[model samples]
Target: MKQDANEFSSFAETIASLGSLTKLESAMSAAIKSSRVPAKETRKMLKCMSIQEAGNTALFQFMRDLFEKVGVGQLVLIRNDIFRYDFAIDNSPVCKLYPHVKGKKTCYITAESLSQFFTKDLGLPGTAEEIACQNAGDNRCEFAVSLQPLAVYQLALDQLDKTIIGSVIDGAGPDKISESLEMSRDEIIFRMNILKRYKILDDDYQITEIGETYHKYGEGMGGDEEEFQPPWKDMAVISNAISASTSFAEAFTEAASQEPLWDVEEKDIVNLAEQAKKSKSFAELLSKQVKSDMEE
Candidate 1:
């Protein structure tokens, strides 16, 4: 959307008023001069700018220019407060606000924000992906943004697969999958049928070799087997090196060690194991290995 120059200037002035233009500019320059810019600080400035009373079109254009100048043009800002800019660009909503209930004063976007944004702006064809945010109290509520369409789809598929498998393994009907994945019975059936067609899910909803591999490694069994290999082997090597060290007590210590083989602590080893368990493939692991070896 186009906006007048006068309106843009007004919005800019409001942004400067919220936070000292001098301070923001200094931070921006400092960040730019450094090897890497601090995105969070930059975003904080933008957030202040966005919340100022201004026309959506003018603010949107201003933000567009600001991010573009900083070499982060593709990144979209999602505002939770309505007083802030609430608009969409490139099939993505920029701002969303949730109603604050008693004792929940923190202003943040809800999971429904993603669902509505994706469904309305992006015009996603299929079912909406379920997303939830974890609060400090360990309570989960709808609040998250999908990194990408494929990522959202993969997450939904994984959830569906897990629910179906868990239910079947427990000798329950597929209804549990529908409930857990927040999909309708029809959707659950359709997804299961598709998996069956690909030989991933069986008649009883049991995970086949293909499904099991995908669950563990995050790649379709029909595709290249290389894609499904987990990075645990490389992580194991790192863990072993860390475990063998006497001076090092953590991965960071081992990584910083001058010795050829660095030592890692039991906790760090377990953390790496967990990461490997969640890794999609060995590519990330291999890349990390190469970097680690180079450092050594």
Candidate 2:
């Protein structure tokens, strides 16, 4: 049997982590920046998940529902692998919209990020290709997550190392990255040297072509799907947080405080806070996000 955790709801944590609605753009920017530079550890993290676990209709449904619950859009699972994420309210403005401008440049970042999320989080094999876009005057945004073969897994970077590489992609020096990522200078130096040894980083701490290619295509094409890890929820703490709160705002704050990893929106947090004041309403709200994660 799996251990029961005393954590807050994952949905509430996601909302709280989003920061203020006013700063959503910056958060999105940060997330985008983080995605551009891939680290070896990121690849390792991705490799931990196998294809058998990720390549299935049920996993796709979970991903689809996750997006919908987060208010990103209404998801239509067109096929086992393909999906249409209709963004009625595009929270990720980083996915540029070329509405009046006549060009077929869809939300490449969004598509790629989704690809990475599926590749890394789910260990599914596919190119998250963008087929349609609202920005292109389409009714919705469509993504063809083609089930394909991941060639191999050939990177071995650790978490801190990957963070450094990602920071470097943002054009930050090792020292600056150290400050930004809160890593010690010595640790940054060590990781940079390792990356350099692997030809992932040049002597000048720049991303080599191989490194660039790895970052660009590795997530979509490398790791083996046979070792995939399933998605999970951390509910106990958030539930306890909610249970302990005297008011909706405190509950919201407690939930938000638990997530330092991702960004969230104030409107969502406020909405969730309002719902969480009543147990029945809150559980119902959580069921929409992730049913299995919440324990009544």
Candidate 3:
């Protein structure tokens, strides 16, 4: 919503502090609902502001700052073109949403539009069908084509890891990085250039000393190296452990709290045991223990 710039900045800072995409989305959605701006418009503006760095660069940067705050990932621009959509999946590509043109024109597709198209026309499973249905209202025929946040998040994370890590380890060009990440070469180059600008790497596609250090010590940098690290490294490890523990707790709760499946007969278990007799380590005693635990 259009709060005073100072007020907006303060609120943005608060949202940034929360550091998780899920939390940020929740906070932003709440703010949008409370603000003078239409909720749908506010959401659309937020999505577009996330991927672009033009007039609304400050706002988008703030959004990206939220990503960094939560320690997930940073938003890096991959491309810009008229009448076309250009972006990277994770940090892999500067994929053009439309064909390129020589002369500049006002023709452009916002990130919202591209997300909608992918969730709708492309038959990408797990797209945000609920959001799409909510946005479309009575025109909900496209609801079947929606994607889930988890699916998108996984795809984005995979692409980012492949691009950034692949480039660092293999000295692969951006094109190779894109291919490895399942993104277009253009997107890889665009995101790589951004990483370069951020001083994460150099123009020669070499990992800078700073980048290497971050790779070794940064949050989520897993390995035995973590044991011999500094206090900040311990802090990162604790944060990661908390995140993992919370996620595991949620998953365990979900599973344990679910309605129990239909019961199986003793005969069924005996028959299954007989069938699994040839299975490796399928001892009758072990199976009995397992069934007993399940029953309890």
Candidate 4:
């Protein structure tokens, strides 16, 4: 009878030990789930390359690669500066926990996190619009990515405006410039007026000294002498060569040949060429510049 009682006591201790082990396991799992620091898997996923000096295309591509590396999902480049991130295969962070939950129209968490990453980490103000989501019963999850800010499109004169100035360098009349640039006559006059306001173009639509400077360095050349400008301003020869070459490849070669004039690496030249290739409008504009150079 005593032996049976001792055996019961041992069984009770064993049961208690099992309970303690289960509790300990549960606590450890909870601690891991609620960890503020990134896990080993997350650290491996976040091994993204630096892109502080990368242009629009490179930046977007890098982000896409980083996301995919972290098991975000496959990314498709919709346009020169836009991407569609689809998170269907392995449910994204936004939908992982709330996979079956319904009634949410947007990926609020994903959008918010991405916005913070772009603005704080990338130094770029951008937007992530979730047009389709798997949680919303869609076959796939999708978000449109744009590197440029909306304010840039709304406030600043665009590539077309600047290209118009480049096309008119040889005193081409509005009619000729319009035909060459494939722009409406009214568009030519409107952009010319804006250039005049900035004192970059005269009444004759000729490029003024300020206009020439602006053409090379953009808004950076506008400030007072004491004000800051990009370090690349000293590389005028290389910049002009790139602008003058008929093709991006040609420009890259020319820039490479004149390496002594600028410290820009060949990889940077390749990146610029790649950026130009990504945009049809930019390619056309460069062609116009090349034609203008020939005329000069």
By TM-score, the best candidate is 4
lDDT per residue for candidate 1 within 1-296, as digits (tens), equals: 11211221222222222122222223223222221212222223322323332223332334344333322123244443311223322311211111111223121222233333334422222232223222222233323334343332342344445557556546655687677667798977876775564456788667778666666666342222112222222334333332343122233333434443235444434433333323323345436557756987
Candidate 3 off by > 4 Å:
1-54, 57-163, 219-296
lDDT head-to-head 1 vs 4, winner: 4
Report the poorest 10 consecutive residues by lDDT, candidate 1. Answer: 92-101
Q: What is the Cα-based lDDT of residue 189 in candidate 1?
A: 80
Runs in model 4 with CA error above 4 Å?
Answer: 1-57, 79-93, 121-123, 145-170, 173-296
User: What overall lDDT goes with each candidate model?
Assistant: 0.36, 0.46, 0.36, 0.45
> Using lDDT as the measure, what is the rank order of every candidate, best first?
2, 4, 1, 3
Model 4 lDDT tens row, 196-224: 75567888888898777767767432222
Q: What TM-score, computed on C-alpha atoms, does each candidate reach? A: 0.21, 0.31, 0.26, 0.33
Give the clashing residue pairs of candidate 4, or none.
none
Q: Under the 3 Å rule for N, CA and C atoms, how many clashes does model 3 have? A: 14
lDDT of 2 by residue, 185-232 (tens): 887887787677567799898999867776666634433324323332
How many backbone overlaps does candidate 2 show? 22
Q: Order of candidates by TM-score, top first? A: 4, 2, 3, 1
Candidate 3: Cα lDDT at 145: 22
**CA error at residue 117 for candidate 4, angstroms:** 3.9
lDDT of 2 at 148: 38
TM-score comparison, 1 vs 2, better candidate: 2
User: Of the pair 2 and 4, which is ahead by TM-score?
Assistant: 4
